[model samples]
Target: MLQIPSWKRILILAVCLFGIVSAAPNLFYGRVEAHNDAIAAAEKAGFETEAQAAARAAWPDWLPSGLVNLGLDLRGGAHLLAEVQLADVYKARMDALWPELRKALADERATVGAVRRAPSDPGVLRVQIGEPAAMTRALEIAASLATPVVSLTGIGQNDLAISAEGDQIVVTLSEAEKLATDNRTMQQSLEIIRRRVDEVGTREPTIQRQGSDRILIQVPGIGSAEELKALIGTTAQLGFHPVIARGSATGTVPGIGQVIYPSVEEKGLNYTLDAVPVVTGEELTDARPDFDQNGRPAVSFRFNPAGARKFGDYTAANIGQLFAIVLDAEVISAPVIQSHIPGGSGIITGNFTVESSTNLAVLLRAGALPAKMTFLEERTIGPELGQDSIDAGSVAALVGMAAVVFFMIASYGLFGVFATVALGINMALIFGVLSAIGGTLTLPGIAGIVLTIGMAVDANVLVFERIREELRTARGPARAIELGYQKAMSAIVDANITTFITATILFLAGSGPVRGFAVTLTVGIITSVFTAIYVTRLMLVFWFERRRPKTITV
Candidate 1:
C-alpha cells in the first residue's frame, strides 16, 4: 500500500474531530436553532462578543418550537385526508340569482304561477317557473342575478341551465357545471391548505391538491391535524342580507344550519313576505379587522363599485330596516340600518374578543373557502408520542453503532479500530448533510441510517479482511497491505453501488415516510464509501511509512 505521511494522517484526524465536535451543537438545537428571540434580541442589541454569539448559537431548544420540528412517524404526528364539497359554489350561484329572478317576475308581474327552486344534482340547482310564456325576459333577468358569472343556458328548447356549474344557474350543474366545479374545488382546496400551513408556522409545508377534489397536506412538526381540519373545513361564508322583516318568535331559517343568535322565539308571524334582503355579502371586495370610530372592535369592508351601487339602491329603497350579516347561513349579527351607505364601504361592529376578531379577519382575508370541506380521514399524533419516538430511534441508533464498533475491533484488532474511527466520521457527515439539506428524519430514515451505519463498517472490514488474506501469503507487511486494497477495491465498489441502487428504488417507488428513509440511507451509503476508502487507506499508508513493521499481524 502507498504509505501516507504521519503529518497528513494527523491533518485528516484533526479535520474529522473538528467536524464531529462542530456537529455537536446541531445534535441539540439543530431542530429548533435555540432561543430564537433571545438570539435575535442579542444580535439587534449589537452583542457581537464571541461569548455572546456562541451562547446564542449553542443555546439548545430544550423545548422545541413549532418551527424546525419533526413530524409524526419521525417525531410522531397524524396524517389526514380531506375532501372539499364541490356543491356549495353551485348553491352560492343559485342564491345570488334569486334576486334577479324576483325582479324580472315582479317587473312584468309575469310569475302569477309559482317561484320554485329545483335541482338536478346536489351541486346543480335549477330554478323553474310555471313554463313562462315569455322565457326570454326571464332568462335575461336571471342572467344578471350575480356577478362573476355569465347567463344560463338550457337543456330543452326554452328552459335555461347555468352554462357551467359555476355560472348563475338553473341547477343540477349541466355537463358544463361538473367540469367547472371540479376545477374550482381543487384550486380552492389547495389555497385553504396553503393558508392552514402558514398558520401552523412551519418552515416549508408540503401541500398537494390531488385529483379533482382531494387535497394532501404535509406539515412537518405539526401533528395537530384535527385543529387544522377544523380551521379548513369551515366554509366561513360571510354574507350581509337585509332582514326585510323579523319573524315574531322566529325559530330558525329553513334549510339553513342552526346556530344561536340573539333572537326572540315568541311566536306571532312565522314568516313575512316583506322580509327580503336589500344587500348581500358578494359585493364585498376586502375585509379587515379594525377598530370602529367609536373604539369598538369591528370588521371593516370595501365593496366593488357595482356592490356600492346595489347597496345604495337597497338602502334607499328600504330605510330604517335590520340588515343581517350572516355567516354560513347563520345570523352572526343583525342591526337596524340608520341611513344609506353609498361609498361601498362599511364596518360591522360587534362584541368580539381579540381572538375572535383576529380569526374572523383571517377567514375573510383567506376568502372563506368556496365550499365546506369534510375530513374523510384524520390522524392526530401528540407531542409526547413524537418525543418517545425520537428516544427510541436514538437508542436503536446508538446500539447499532456500538455493535459495528465492537465488530470492527474484534475482527481487525488495531486496524479494525482505524476503520471504526473512519466509520464514526462517516456518520457525523451524514448528520451534517441531513441538517444542511433540511431533510425530514422520518422513522424509515432512522432505519436507513442504522442500516448504513452497519454497512459502513463493511468497507473497512472488506479491506482489513483482504489484507489478512494477503498477509497469509505475502513476504512483507508493505506488500500485503498494498495487495489487500488493490484486491478489495473492486468488491467495495460493486457492493456499495448495488446497495445504492436498492436505496434508489425505495426512494422512488416507496410512498410517504418510506421515501424519507430511502433518501437518508442513500446519502449515508455514498458518504460511507468515501470515508472507508480514503480514511482507512490513509491510516494504513501512514502506519507502513513510519512503523515499517517487519511482519504484519493486524
Candidate 2:
C-alpha cells in the first residue's frame, strides 16, 4: 500500500513511458543499416571521419535535426529583436507617388524640381524642389499618391523642401494620418514576413509583433540562422512583360499600354510585341517547388479565381508571342505561348538543385518581409560546448536529487523515504512532458526544474506535519493518514497557485530563453502538485490499509 495505488502509480508511470517511447525511434535508427549507407556516403565525400559520419547519419527523425542539443546560449546561436524601418516603407510609397505627382504636376513645363535617382542607393529617388510656388506642382500630384500624406514645415519659406519633415522638407503627418498609415504599414510588414517565412519553410517558427514595430522570431530546428537572415533581408521586386512582335517592332513602340520584356540586355531593348502578362506575380496565391513530368526542377504557382480569369484572357489575346518571367526585375525564362491557360495553376521551369528547390519553396511560402531586419545579436555553439553543458546540467540535477532524497528520508523516517521516491517520479514527469511537447530545456529551465524539486516535496511535508499533529492527539494510523491529506490539500493548492501566477508573468515579460524558463517552471509546478498531493497520498493510504496500526508515528 505504501507504493501508490495502481491508478496514481500508473498516472505517473505513463509520462515516463511516453518520454522513453519518443526517444526510442531515434535510438533504433542509430543501429539501422540505412543509416550505415548514409554514413558510407558521408565518409566517401570527405565531409566526416568514419566515426563522425556514423554518428551523424545515425540520427533518426525523432532526434533533433541540427546542432541545438544544449540549446541557444550554450551552443552559440542568434537571438534578434528587430523593428521594421517604417521610414523606408514610407519612402517606397512616396517614390511610387512621385510618378503620379509628376504626372499630376506635369503642367506643360515638366518644370519638375531637379529629379534624379536617390544618391544613397539606386532603389529610391530624391527630388529637390525650388521655391514654395514650385513645390506646388508636387502638391498638385500629391492626391495621386493614394496613401496617407504628411505636410512639410522646414521649407526655406522662399525655398520649399520636398524632402524635409516638420520644419524641414519632410514634415510631420496629421495625427489621424500617422495612426492610419502606421497601422497599415505594420500589418503589411507582418504579412510580408509571414509569407516570406512560409516560403522559406520554417516548420514551426514563431513570428509575432511586439508593440508597434518590433518582430520576434523563434525557429526551433533552424541550422543556418544566417540563411534565414539573408532571405528575410531581401526585398524582391518581380515583373513580366510581352516580347515585341517581329512585324510591329520596326522603330515603333508596339507595346503602348503593354510593358514588353524585349530580347535586349536592358529595359530599352526592342523586338517585343508578343503580348501582355495575364497576371503579375503579385496575384500569386500560393507557390511551391515541384518537378515536371521528366522530373525537371521547377516552381509551381496557383492563382486565385480572379487571377486565373485574367491570365486566361491575356493568353487568349496573345496566343502566338513570347512572355518573359522576370524575378527581381531580371528575365529568368521566356516561354513561348502555344495555347491559352484558363486554369490558374502552372509551374515555373528553371535550372535548380534539390537544396535550391527547398530554399525557394521556403521563400515562396513565407512570402516577403515588409522590410529587412539586421541581426543585433548572433551566437552559434559547437557540439563540444553543448555536450559539456549537458554533462554539467546532468551532474547538477543528480546532486540536487540526491540531496532531496536524503532530506526526505531523514525528516519523516520511513514515510519521508516514500515521499522522496515519489519526488523522483515527479521529476521524471516534468522531463517527460517537456520532451513530448518539443520544449527546449534552457539553463534557466534547468533552474526551474531544480526549484521544482523542492516544490514537489512541499505537499508531502505539509501532509506529514498534519499527520504528526493528529497523532499527538492519539489518532489511529488510518484516520491520521486520511485527515492529513484532506487538511493539507488547501495549503498545497494555494502555494502552487501563487507560483503559477509568477510563472505566467515571466513568460510574458521576458524574451527568448527567459520565457523558456517560465514555461518549464509552470509545467513543473503543475506536475509537482499532482505528484505531491495525489501520488503521495495514494501511497500513504495503501500503506495504512495494509498495516492497520493502532498508533501512528513518523
Could you say which candidate leads in TM-score? 1
Candidate 2 residues lying further than 4 Å off, grouped into runs, are: 1-71, 74-88, 95-220, 234-237, 241-280, 290-296, 306-323, 334-346, 354-358
CA lDDT, candidate 1, residue 94: 52
Per-model TM-score versus the true fold: 0.70, 0.69
Worst 10 residues of 1 by lDDT: 150-159
Q: Give the alpha carbon lDDT tens digit for every residue of 25-120 in model 1.
A: 455664245455456556655666565566555565453222323545655444667777776666555555555565565665544245555545
Please write out the lDDT profile of model 2 over residues 1-554, one tens digit for every residue. Answer: 13455775677557555544544443353254345445555654557666656565566645533211235544434344667776665554444444544455445345544432222332233444444455555544443344433324322221112343221124223344545556767777667766766543343455677887777665433565675567666654444466654332445643222343433233444444323343566577777778977798878888778888877887788788787766544455667778988798777776767676666656655554445555555443444665676667778878888888888888889899779867876776676566557566777777787888877888889989998987888776777777878889899899999999999999999876778789889988988887787767666666767776777668
lDDT of 2: 0.62
How close to the true structure is residue 48 of candidate 2, measured as C-alpha lDDT? 65
Q: Candidate 1, TM-score vs. the true structure?
A: 0.70
What's the distance in Å from true for residue 323, model 2?
A: 4.5
The clash tally of candidate 2 reads 42
